[model samples]
Target: MVSIGLKGLRHLDQKPTLSKANRNSFTNEYWKGVRVKFIIQAAAGGISFMLLFLACSCYLYGSLYKSHQRYHNFRILAVDYDGGVIGKALSAAYEELKRPEFPTLYFHSPEDFPTPSDVYQIVRNGHYWGAIYSTKGASDRLEAGIQGGQAATVYNPNDALYWVWNQQYYTTFAQSVVEASIEQLVSAARAAYTKINGTQAFPYVAQSDPDAVQAFLNPIAATVANVEVDAQDSVFLFTSISMVMPVLQQFFFLLALNGVSREHQLYSKMSVRSSMIIRGVAGLLYTFGAALTQAGYYWAFRDGWKVDGNQFVLTWMVLWLLMHTHFTYLDAISAITPISRMPFAVLTWIFLNISTTISPLELQPGFYYWGICLPASNAYSVLVTIWSGGGDNRLYRALPIMFAWWIVGNLLSMAAHLRACHLAYKFDKEQQNNKGDGESAMGMTPVGSEVTIRPHSTNESAAHDDLQQDKTLEEQDLEQRQIYGPSIPPPFA
Candidate 1:
């Protein structure tokens, strides 16, 4: 008997248990919910996430990759005024040596070539990366120096000028490439001249000697001098941190907004004034918490904690204020409009992708350049200034913008709350009037006591009978309560 019982127990264990079956059934039902409308929403959310991910990734990786690949097909404006043999030879060598893997020289010598100031303006406007100018008698000077044996006096009035923008990655890279190209061309031209004239030109030494050859090859080197207009070197960590700043802001803003919205819904039955106050307080707390959390992140990963203490504190405060304002703005939007959280989330993502830190703001086109005035952009500017030790001058310039956003958002939110309060009061008053009417019609006192009344005339009695036949005021009030009670307002009004 014991053996048989054990065999039965083993068989029962091998079979699917009731709990397991129930869990399986529950999972199936849960999965079944992901159909039709659920699928549409899920698909939309998935697409939005993908787009946001791609935009951010493109901005970060695309900028870096473009900087790396900028040497390929890099365009440099060349204004050649030396229409001589040496100048032609050097220009031809530059063009021939230009490769797909290296920068290509585009020589432009229009009849009316742009003046130096024009070239400066063109570069400043980002029309070209840099410009090379060869003076009118460059080749004449070179040939005369070679034939006259005036090696020390042999100089080409050719120069490379680069426009220095706020972001120096592309400018610096282009400058280096162009400078190297100019040196190579000079060496090639000198070699050709030596072969034709049977004498060294620049170094005034025989090409057979190694030191002499080196000197001849590098007779004159190009020096890059930047015209600084608030330009700074592109630090990888700083750029990366700036790109990440907007993401943190968007996340915390949405988080706080969603939390406040939910809190408001839960306490919606309370007076509007109380609800607004509670939401405002919740927003402040969440902003503070998020700021602290971000500060920790910056300290641990960005080395912000170990760096300048005052700057870090200032950055934290700015971030806190910005987040608070952003959350308040979203709350106000929700209160006044029928727009949902998804749209706001998408807008935040847009701001993150378009901010100046991810890509050079100056390089962007018109609409994108305008995006620099956004709150995220302002915050990025402040953080970058603090990080770069640009002092309080730059930081102060951005503070006013942040403050403005805060004030505007708070005012709009307050207005929404006041409007809600007014509506609620009106609704409550209407309900009270309906209740009073119901009591009068039922001949009952407000205390729920029965009241007796005498009929005045036949016409009055008939009207009263008709009123009794109609739906009672209590029923109407009950219906109104049913319609309005336990209802959470839509995200959009």
Candidate 2:
């Protein structure tokens, strides 16, 4: 049945010319074209690009946090009453917090007693995230678990748990350090108290009396309340901004390959006048269209995505349009000198394949040229700057580079158009010249008069020959005149 149907269809159908097939194929072709353009744009700077951007941002965010933590972690300032053993123990505890694994710990020794005001000033200056001040006998009090006795005082500049915990840990660790340091002093004090008053030996473990510890540590540990400090995500913002390079590169590649190439091929045969106007209009329309599409989707899903919709939308739109403009200009050029297409295509692919740095400019400084020269590189940098938010500085700084590509592209397009036109003119002239030569060669001149002359004859024989030739010419001219009217002159006349 299938074979029968196929035979019937084939028999019924008459094959059409290639031109007709093209016209029939236009509808699907247009949609396919649009899809290709979209794909290129998306691939250049689309979801994958965004994901890469996000990944870089996330990576940079983590890095920034590490840097921030390096400077602003936990801090400790201790004053001890028992010689300096208690202070040494507190310092040792603070030193333990300084290891890289520790989140945020800073230790400081103040000439004057550490105060809430001092911590506030430091935190306000954005130096320290949290601060801690330790008092002497604070450890002894912790052992007792008692309420109101002389408690080793801990002052928190920033209400960070690390400091509070540090005060606790400091007390524990310091108590151990102090216990080891002042074993002789403590032993002497206990033995003196026992021998002088006739009491028993000091207990195996050090005494853990809160009130007693407080009394002993008090003057040394100034009474200060907790001061809460808020930390800003400066690092996250910075990291996020740094990831824009990848996004820009992705976008540029899409624009150059899909959008530019497609448009160029489509309008390849259009009149120069129409082509220029249509190209400009189409570029503007598509750019705005792309921007609006992205803006609308982003606005709807911004919150869920944890990005600033309004800013993101605006940036996305601007970057999208900029990329479209770049692509359109490139298309114009590609249309003119299609010979350059292969090179342009290869370079575009390379740019897309290259990995963008987290802070490309900041890291290498030299890569700026490579990033700026290529369409994908420029687009990636622009997108990263726009999407990430922090690199507005870098973006603005890099503006000239981006602008340069656009200008150069537009110039190339103009040059290509001129070149195409010049080539076309030369071709037309050559054709016209060839046609004229062919026409001149095919045209005829009369056979006898000026074109072919009878030679002068001497004697009676030559006269007879001349008369015969003249008679022939007369006959031929008569026939020519009869057929073509009086246009041929009569030889006899």
Candidate 3:
């Protein structure tokens, strides 16, 4: 056994371990040069990456956080067709409820009574959270009901219905507040009428009683309906996840593209097909990994695993394909214009995060609403439809937009890659021709003619020496490929 152990030790000594080989590579003079180049490249890339990361982080987190903090900054439109005591009372009630310090709804009354179609258009445009319509007979109807011991018809859809543009996120909170305020206003009006007339507007009765007086005193009612958009459950969680998921996905894609681009630059002699295959494989892995991670996160925290299996699977597949196509485009962009990676990354981050995924697209200005058609925005719509159930039509609509992005991004990326490869090949061939010409001239000089050695004047020699130094600097530059690589031009240059 000791002899065998000694032989094993000798064999181990003869064979270099991976760590030893790595250590030697680091210390080796040729590898030291490579290491230095790598560090320089890494440093340049790192600084640009850090700048872009900080910008994206600041914009995303800062804007989202601030919006959350200031969620109360919403305006509501109130139309008083009643033009009577009760109309003024309801408007005053809403006005009184407005508190600047908290999330409060500000109610604005138009100078003239707006038609129902006008109200709908205004709300649809998302200028206000909702609009309240009070009919001319609202006060008279309540008074007649109170006097005749009958239920008041206060919330007629033709007269006094509150049409709320129900978005799942901001509208829920705003709706609750509006409903509560209307109830309070009605109660106060009933109490005032009773005090002046010396009688109770509503008197409690047995369980079997129709409770006409109670209805009269609390006549204000609301019908909450979603229009042009679907209501979402768990609004806060859904919105937060929508923002975070895209940021994480884009970050992973940037890393994958950057790595693949560096690999291509270092192995410039790699066949184009092989390089594309490697990038495609890397993008696939990244997309799959990111999709799994996002899905797992949703499952663990958002009860996604308990969701309908088919819907969950479909959502996951959609997310995966979206990321795969997006990353593939990024990989091609990296290959074509590596220096533009940072700018493109920042632009994409802004587009995904600032778009309508986390909020109502209608709430944004008209110009920004166009961004709702972007792939990220459409993806969020599909995600919400799948997660919350229903809205098959929305999912269907979003599908075409997603497909368009996938197709367009891939096509543009491929074209750019082909162009870049052609340029690189042309550059390489020109370099080879220049080198061959220099070699041929040197070889033919002695064979074709007697070579004369000429002595230069001091000024001429100085100029020649300077030219030699410039040539050495150019050679050194050619040896060191900057982070942009030889093929890619510097950004904005």
Candidate 4:
């Protein structure tokens, strides 16, 4: 409440009002400062964008640059049980093709693996990318067939070369690169075999047994079996950088979470821990819905692109964990990173994480080896395993990394949230203190002719003059009410 003596009340009606020109004496100076600041900010923005472009190029392109140079990282085991010509030829053929860009085939004796099932286990267990094996008596069967007798009628050509690989492990890569390379390998091996046997078999090539004739012609018919068929070309989008799209969408979710908290002053009203918990719980719930939506796309698009799933529940769980990993980490970033700079931070994070997942770790440079530890890469590994029906089964390996990201992101976010809360509480207290000071000062400070103003952002001192003016009329009304009866409020009015 403002109190005014009779003398002050009489003079209040006579107070002077400043003209528009006089109201802001330094308008030119303020506008000039704004213009200068705008120019500086514009220059800074251009430079920042240029830097971001350069930095993100390295993040996005690092793995892709000379990607094939590291392809020897894919290990293939070559085992020969036949211990004969075709096996020797295939081994030699594989060696001839063993460039740095191609998967290297390590030759192993039949003694190393008890049976073909052992090779299958090696492939399935992902100890190696694939295996080339000649079954027992492969050369013997082909030899008997070539000789042309009773053996010629019943001889099987497929018994020669068998390729054990799970195309489901990386369908696109297998089809485009691995399969093509395998075809070349088989062709070369066949040619090598024909060169050696063509002269010997030509005289006996007149055999009437069609099965044996076919076997003699193409003795090594390499058959590749997909341990689990994952031929879907559409999974590329879900496997690559596109997979992180939904994760990137969480920036807006974070913005919305912040908008409400800021507008409603939710953080200011609650204890620090409670406010952060609300944010976490809200983010988790939102991520749950997002995960379901992603999983639904995986299901809904099955017929269109096909990643057949009885794995819906597991898919949803993976998506939930994956998206939440992004959310919690981004939330922590936003806690420290200003909203204006968050786009850069987000872009950099997305590019960095997605780069690690673009190709097989072997195809990427060693510098990117550690990137597999990134949450997005780990999430992708797990998702691919799920999509392939556990083909490349990196589940146990990737889960721990994803969990580690969650733990670190939450811990960092909690610390940042506490700091932010402390600052907010401190600011609120300062505002309350300043408000009390302003109210106290006004009661003693002379107004109108003797008033003084100071420009301080947090202090409300500049508004004291306007506040005093508003109180003038209220003070007059109070004086009249005290002096007159309620019915005879004013003299004639």
lDDT of 4 at 276: 77
> Worst ten-residue run, lDDT, model 2?
160-169
Q: Model 4: per-residue lDDT, tens digit, 379-471? A: 877876776566677778899988998888888878767766765566557556666655755543545556555446424554565355443
Clashes of 2: 21
User: Candidate 2, residues 368-435: lDDT per residue as tens digits?
Assistant: 33544544445544544444343323455446766776677667665655554444445446545655
CA lDDT for candidate 3: 0.54
The TM-scores of all predictions, comma-separated, are 0.49, 0.38, 0.52, 0.80
Off by over 4 Å in 4: 1-37, 207-212, 304-310, 437-493
lDDT per prediction?
0.53, 0.40, 0.54, 0.73
User: How many backbone clashes are present in model 4?
Assistant: 0
User: Higher lDDT: candidate 1 or 2?
Assistant: 1
Clashes of 3: 0
Could you give candidate 3's per-residue lDDT for residues 1-493 as a string of tens digits? 2243655765754454523654565667868668988999999888977877776566445434434334345555667766655566555555554454233444445454456566656655445555566665766665555544433323232233444553432434444543444445444443443444324334432223334444444545444434434333454665555455644565456654544464445234567777556655766777787777676666656432236567757767877866766665554555455454546554655455454565554334344556667667777667755653443236557888888878887777656556555655655565666555554433334466876544447445645554453435455334323332323332333
What is the lDDT ranking, best to worst?
Answer: 4, 3, 1, 2
Best by lDDT: 4
Weakest lDDT window of 10 consecutive positions for candidate 4: 482-491
**Global fold similarity of model 3 (TM-score):** 0.52
The alpha-carbon lDDT assigned to residue 477 of candidate 3 equals 38
Say which prediction, candidate 1 or candidate 3, comes out ahead on lDDT. Answer: 3
Q: List ranges where model 2 is wrong by over 4 Å.
A: 1-275, 294-303, 306-309, 332-354, 357-392, 429-493
